[model samples]
Target: MTPMLLVMVAIGGTDILFALDSIPAIFGLTQNVYLVFTATAFSLLGLRQLYFLIDGLLDRLIYLSYGLAAILGFIGVKLVLHALHENNVPFINNGQPVDVVEIGTGVSLAVIIGVLAVTVLASLTSARGKAQNAVAAARRHAAEYLDMAKDPIRRADIFGKLLAEQAKIRALPEKYRAQIREEQELMALLHRAHAEHGSTSAR
Candidate 1:
């Protein structure tokens, strides 16, 4: 096969593996093969986009792996319970169905969607919160250094540190980049002042 064909085959494999759980999970709602097939098709169709969306954010969300595991576990438990409810094994429950309530397909769908929504929201919120906190802390440290900068040498040191922090924040497309710009402005002023009064500025 051509390289493109090989790549397509690999991606198809990945898609099939990923959808394995949902194939059976949807059947829990109804034994209607057509309904199950339609629902799974619709669901996986949207997942192609979702895969990229989550892939970009995987680095930001530290607990994403745990969240996915929880989802799979929940589905596995649901399927097991369903099997027990439809029990036909002669060795268990006298070949009778389980007495416990079986979760309906609608409820299963709702719970799965709810958990996924919450997981994505929580991950993004947490990642943004930590980023904000770091920016705030950098601001506070820069302010302290500015206050303590009585001599030109001390001021230059403060400017260096602030510029370093600025470089870090420049990658984030937010208000923090503006704050870094302000720091760069201050650093330039300090550099000009030090150049003009070189005699006393070094000490």
Candidate 2:
């Protein structure tokens, strides 16, 4: 999955293999090539929309990978069994040639739908908890600086130190350094303004 090509190949191969089993299974059912073609055409048309929906929901479902693995494993076994049945392999213990391929396809589809439902629900719950945690952390950081403002000289020193720390953090973004410097200039201007007002009022 780390490599894009690997994932594409794996999914593409599985899709083609599944289609092979599907065409035979459908033929066994209706024996109408035209009907099969129609169904397949419609399916292809709809699948792109389904893929978009699945991609959007994938991140929410914590169990998505596990569910998909179980489903694919089940389908793969069924496909092998169906192929063996078609070949008249005797090891099936007289099991009814019950079209296990179609059954597997149905089960895999149901599991995918169920997993998507659960994943969406779980994601919404997780998102709420994460939002609350972020707010609490920000509040805690603000309280730390509020404590620093208790003594005037200490406040002034800490204010300069905090500005430097913020500048270092902001400098990485390039534009942010200019913004931080402007804030520092504004702070200095305010201090000078206050000193001038105090002197004039005393006179």
* Most accurate candidate by lDDT: 1
Candidate 2 lDDT, 83-107, residue by residue in tens: 6656554556554354543445455
Q: Which candidate gets the maximum TM-score versus the true structure?
A: 1
lDDT of 1 by residue, 59-141 (tens): 45655677677767777788788889989999989899988778777887787778777876786566353454445445544
lDDT by candidate, in order shown: 0.65, 0.51
TM-score per candidate, in order? Answer: 0.54, 0.33
Which 10 consecutive residues of model 2 have the lowest summed lDDT?
129-138
Total backbone collisions for each predicted model: 0, 0
**Consecutive 10-residue window with the lowest summed lDDT within model 1:** 127-136
Report the number of backbone clashes for model 2.
0
